[model samples]
Target: MTPEAPPTTPTQAVEIVRSRYAQPKLPDGTPAELKVHEFDIGYLVFAVFPPRTDAAGRPQPSPPGGAKIVVSKETGETVTVPNYPTEKAIALYRKNVERNA
Candidate 1:
């Protein structure tokens, strides 16, 4: 796919997150809880919850992957690297937030 323009708003960021993690909602087709946070690690990390998807495929309230987007704070800049734990990404995001604050 061709590169897209950078998102200038949190709503746009939500749209970006939903593109990959579609079908996110409750069993009754209601919207689920979603969130966006401050930027860090050269990126912005947004979480799109699945209503009930946990790390082990359990129907829990939280998940660790396939439900997050680490968009660069600037164009084409990624915070995550290959073969790293997702916790690191979160850490980096928090660090950047701290730095920016």
Candidate 2:
């Protein structure tokens, strides 16, 4: 098999994550959107969540423990981690990258 090409831009990186990871479904059985929660030069972290507002128009609290998808800009590779704060997720991704390097 051919190796995947590395992502050229942040937008491309997001696309990679979208294609590779499946968005989680809400209690209503609707698939949540993959939103870009954070990023740096090397990685883009996505949060799986429902819309910002509910049908009643109230703000939605972010779901607990939804997995975050991290995409590597250099390799177009991905890592999924438990729902963590952006900083912690990036730190874990960096550690994994280092270990694999």
On TM-score, the candidate that comes out on top is 2
Alpha carbon lDDT of each predicted model: 0.52, 0.67
- Candidate 1, residue 19: how far the Cα is off, in Å: 3.1
| Candidate 2 C-alpha lDDT tens digits along 1-101 | 12277777767767777677675677688876556654554565565554677898999876466667776666667778777877887788788878978
Question: Which stretches in model 1 have alpha-carbon errors above 4 Å?
Answer: 40-66, 76-88, 92-101
Off by over 4 Å in 2: 1-3, 26-31, 37-41, 48-63
lDDT per residue for candidate 1 within 1-101, as digits (tens), equals 12255666666655655564554566677776656554542344443444566678677644344434565545533333322346665675566756977
Candidate 1 CA-lDDT value: 0.52
